[model samples]
Target: MTKRNEPLAELVTEAGLSEGGLARRVNELGQDEGLQLTYDYTAVYRWVRKGQRPEPPVPSLIAQALSERLGRQVRPSDFGMTDTASLATRALTYNSDVPGTVDTILELGRTELKSRGMQRRRMMTAPFVLAAAAGPSRDWLLSTLDETFDQDAPRKIGMRQIDGIRGMFKIMQEMDVMRGGGHARVTLVEYLSGYVLPLVRRQHDQEAVQLALYEAAAEQAYLVGWMAYDDGQHGLAQRYLIQSLRLASASKNKVLGAHVLAGMSDQANLLGYPEEALALARVGQRGITISDSPACMADLQILEARALAALARDGRPKGSVTEAVRRAEATFQHVRPDNEPEWARFIDPAYLYGEAAHCFRDIADTAQIDRFASESAAEAARQHRARRGALSQAALVSGDLQRNEIERAATRGQTVISLAETVESSRCIETVRDLTKRFKPHGRMPEVQAFQARAGQLLKVA
Candidate 1:
């Protein structure tokens, strides 16, 4: 047995208190905090003789009791234990009015991105991640309606801010499609830190502010889930995605909420939880229907089709795909919004087409996949080269249709790794790996062989 009568015991002795007396004082303090404690002489004896640690709140109460009795700042550490100082400090430092606190959070996020092997690091205390994940929603829900940008306030934001954020989001999405979430994990975190965090600091109308916060929170949770997904932490990823959904709800942004739900569905499908994926996708579709935006509705429908296809729900998937196509075409027929949210603008006909192709591919519907994939490929070709990752996905589906093993592997592998270099989501790498796995059984294909060799070499160094 370990010795317990150490510094805390010494302190109690110095205070001229019997073991029963110290326990009584500590129990009284616990009552003030509405904590019921069964502590008595035996508990005090256990602390003194066995180094017994009290549960949460009890430690603070003991410290408080000691401080009051001794007339000094008696900390937990003073009792021969390390205090939970970090949590205490975080609680004390949390300030909605202080801009510096926001900067600090951004800086921490940046540091996390820059650290080696950060994406692979599993959080020891899951509650901390859960707490942080819930923060954006809580802030949005409780924020005052009077909060608005000051007209005379300095324009701390600029066009570059918007461009950088949109660019990163696009890049990450492509990387995610091409490789897997694993490869793009770090880039996503960097984007969250450099782009999303700063935008969160900007002053705006209550609605705008909430919307921005929702996007940031969703993106943050996306990255978090992506990392967890890459590392095979399904439960953690699900929790983050759920928290993201709550944040989106708090913002009253139905479209974004649908997007988050779709992402969660994707993760569910990936983990072989097909029923859960279908359920989440249906929820996303309902949310989009309520959103009343044709573009948003189409995007959600496309996501629903993807989930249903994963579950091999033939009729539902086909109907959802048809509806998505019709809705997306209708949305594109109209003039696009001039001041559209950057993330929303990406959810157009091309996006829906690509997603539809993916759904068909999941269900092994080569004919439908080929048709949609070809159309999406043509659209992607016309789009900017920066969107090479998205185009590469279309190329992947088409190459699969043509049975061009070498070209498919080479193109998919190149685009995937290239995207991985820029973004930090491991999902991107996993996507590429999955493609490569499909060709592994047929090892005779020289191009597939070569691509695998190259990828193996890259992994050794990476």
Candidate 2:
């Protein structure tokens, strides 16, 4: 049996309270905070003996209540545990004050970027998820929109701060593509709660502030959806992406909206919902066509082509890939970001080539796939070595065409799988899975079997 005089029990005794008494106090505290706790003396005893921890907001409330009743500060450590800090903890603490939340979130973003994948252990901790689920989205929305900007005293954030946040976003995006959303989801959630939430509270010129808020909200929503996708929570991801689209729409930033829509379309395509993917890509195209931004138009056209390729792969709809390619070629003629977000800085000729290659590969057009795949691979290699994520994507396209050789494709596939384990994106895994599934129907070719085996190994990790 466990010792009765454990830290929590000792603390309870020190306060002149029995296990039942402590549980009652905790319950009362929960009541004050609008939470329902079914905990009892037995629960308290288990926590004391078995190291079970209470959910957050509860832990803080217990501390507050014990301090009030005993006339002494009751630290959670006194009960053999640290304070329950979660993504929602900071957000909830500052929900009544937007500026505080924004400050906390910015600091959090910087911390996340600096640490890279080191902080992933805390991503899906129980308290963090509980708190994130409890976030006051409605309150945040109201507060964000209520503030009008003062043109005379507009607040200016430093470029360094923005860059730090962007860098974090980039890393997370890459991780999500490589590994799927499961590994570092909590980190992304905490990022939104600590960095993006606070920015939403800032006061600025109406137009500028609104634009900033919309972008931030869109990013937050995208991260949330990406996390959900990683966890295989497809329904949740869809909902969050839809919410992100709404936020983008509110800002009237069609470019960002198109990006989010493309993401949604990508998710749909991966889920085998090719028709839905095509429809969403069409929406993005329509939005881009009407906008004055040529670069944004090109990006959307590429996205549309990807969706069209997926539809063609599903054996539905005529001229999908052809139409997509035609539009993409036209957009390529006028691609430049006059005033684009930092997140989209890398969507260049290489990106178009890569996306086009994937589309042709999906349609099983070996010649076109080879042509675009080689060009994309070379372009991606030329840009940055740190883009293991993009390289993995290009490798997937190449793998699709190299289906005849299990040995040749297996080496490259293994490299991608290794890289995929470190990143947080589901797209890479989905691509590999799709490739494997496509080849499975062709019977037991030695090379295909070997590639499938390698893919299976990677899927287990994902």
Candidate 3:
């Protein structure tokens, strides 16, 4: 890799600024975002001469500073730090080829393991861009699966190792459900980087063993993506999920690929992209055999219902929400616990009811909200899943508020807060926040005001 800063030097020269002048400008720009930087000429000199990379937002800030100086649009790539700095940017993209996608995932995993600050990076909920997913979805749809996975090397891997990986993923997933991804997301990424990546990278003689390894690797990637999602890193989660889809396709595992797409769809809907979410859900449905995985089928349909409900909330169409809900219900009836994948084990009646309650709530269907939310709460408690229970209770608060039952809603709101007090889930926190928003019209009342005070205090502590 080249360790030169000729481009930055040229840009600095073109702007007609000395090293001290550039540093002052950069610091002034940093102040706009409440950053107190005391950079001087030496800092600028090292960046332009020694090929040092500026910290994030700083790179963008540098671009902004130069853009203002040059009176034009300048990007970070123009800084001549492409070899090392560009890996992070490239990691977010869904590349067209499998090897390129694998490279992106590997680079991201390595960074996440090496840098605590990167692991702690706040998950920005940027508005969903439809174009971002279009090409990846098309590539997955049109690509042909590999007929054989044979390799010519001495290092042999077998099914036992693959099964061990799968079992570990299941354990990690259980941890995710109970404690949320905040608890173990970083550790899991480290495991993927240190252990799982090498196993898949090794050569194997048997095609079956190789496929199994890739399938296990894909599942691990999907879990990593989900952890990122739960930790609020929406864009990073999408990139990991796209890589999971590519790996699953390489292994000739359509059901697993469909599951990855389902996750992407969920992220899209959660971040407020109903159209793209619904389209991704439909893409998950294509080429999946019904008998192969009933639970996954139900999960995809329910996600489609979720996207439809979101569309209704945006005032696009109302009828599709109900119809989608019905389809989800019908599909869920076929879920055979004995035949389902372990990853989809959580997609039982309680989960479906919780999702349905949100859908009905979105379309302002108070009757369905009452019915589904109540049922979800009942089943969630029976299943010992506090996160879902809290969410359902929050939905009940929404339902009660919709029906003008202020005291009942406030009481349920308190229950959600109590249930979520010990959990580290942003989704649960946001649920309570949404319930608070629903109480805005009745904020003057003492019961609602008391609930508001308690909820705010709890979240502040959390």
Candidate 4:
């Protein structure tokens, strides 16, 4: 016999919803994700009275519905439908406590290892929780990072060892650029879980030595997060980025911390939460100063522009978008690669213009897209063509589409396919899929059909 589900029953009541209302709400939310749910009052009764669980997505859909009603970050575990081990559940907290932060990060890496490869994405329809990111972004903004190294335990780690680790990660970063995060993110996780964890555990009498170790670890973790983002495992990336931010904070490395926050902002924008994205980018801007690398500052500024452009497209004024883009371009001119931190050196012209093109696309400003996107694609690393080049080339297709140049857009789309095929990123696949969606209206045309046929073969979307 099943026990009563008091938690679920109480939550429904606290949300001020009747069983029928909750069922209808879940079905509505499911429809947003293309799920045809038949949940009714009896289905809610089975959950509340008989401890019966709904199928995979329905439970998450219920959580999302109640979260909106309650105006808080609700989880399946909150109502006893699942446990805290769930990715969204585990990522919900900022872990302000001392060893709890460390432990939480370790557990997250372990969980990633056990998640049966990239299949973790299949666990949820909407994986990245915007609310989960909000808590940590605010927590880091308010945090003093006063936590000191434990002097009573462990051994000292030298700067040379940290340098060596960075040297190796440089190669991994290159691979991620060329081959996509899917190709190397797991191996990166293996290194973080095995070798880096021990380094993080070691203590030293020299504060400088310890800080270097923390900074190095934070950067490595940030790379893992970046790879995960590139691979399209956004929820997993969000978790890793929070941990990386904490480590950077612990090291008192404000520059790296700002970079991590900027990464968070980019992820948020890409995930369609431009408001949260803008807020995160502002906090990142506030967290650093002019003394920091100009490249890092420029990156944040462009991210802000991207968010503003997204908002503009959603009915906000274009004035803010224009100003933000100007600031980004002006700041990018100040980027001195030799003076920049190794991590920030990637902020080259190609990268800056690539992002600029994206912002212009969001606001439906095709005038600048041709110049910026073409520059981005042309300036792509000559030694190895990668996902960034593919993404930059994609903006051309969008710009062409916005102008009703179906033949030109389809022709350009084949170039995107050629560039995207060199990498294993799901983000690349998703990019073409988005273009294909736009191509649907013009599908009867021979040119449009050609692009659709090619994109369909590459995307293989369900």
Better of 3 and 4 by TM-score: 3
Q: In candidate 4, what are the lDDT values of residues 1-462, reduced to their tens digit? A: 988899888888999999999999988887887988888999999999998876566767888888998998676656765422344565556666534555556656665665442334343232677777777777777763333334333222446777787886787888887798888887887887788767778767887777777787888889998998888888778878888888888777777888999999999999899999999899888877655668988899999999999999879998888789789888877777777777876688888899999999988889899889988888885645568788888999999999999899999899888878888898888888888888889989998898888888887742
Model 2 lDDT, residue 318, Cα: 39
Where in model 3 is the C-alpha error above 4 Å?
A: 1-85, 116-130, 144-158
Q: Which stretches in model 2 have alpha-carbon errors above 4 Å?
A: 1-185, 199-207, 227-232, 314-318, 337-339, 383-415, 435-456
Better of 1 and 3 by TM-score: 3
Put down candidate 3 lDDT per residue, 1-462, tens digits, no spaces.
Answer: 436598899998998889999899889988998999999999988898888877766777777788988998666656743222445455556666655666567666765654344422432332234566766666666653323323332222445777688788888988888777677887788877778877777778887787777778888899998987877777777778878888888777777888888898889889888789888888878747566677787788889999998877767788888888888888888888876767888888788889999998888899999899899999888877788899888888888888898999998888899878867777877877787788888989999999999989877876
Better of 1 and 2 by lDDT: 2
Best by TM-score: 3
In order of lDDT, best first, we have: 4, 3, 2, 1
In order of listing, the candidates' clash counts read 23, 17, 0, 0
**Model 2 lDDT per residue over 366-396, tens place:** 6777677667667655754223344535445
Q: Considering every candidate listed, which one attains the maximal lDDT?
A: 4
Ranked by TM-score, the better of candidates 1 and 2 is 2
My TM-score estimates for the predictions, one after another, are 0.55, 0.59, 0.78, 0.76
TM-score of 1: 0.55
Tens digit of lDDT per residue, candidate 1, span 304-376? 6666666565344455555544554555454255533445556654566777777767666666776776676
Cα lDDT computed for each candidate against the true fold = 0.56, 0.59, 0.77, 0.79
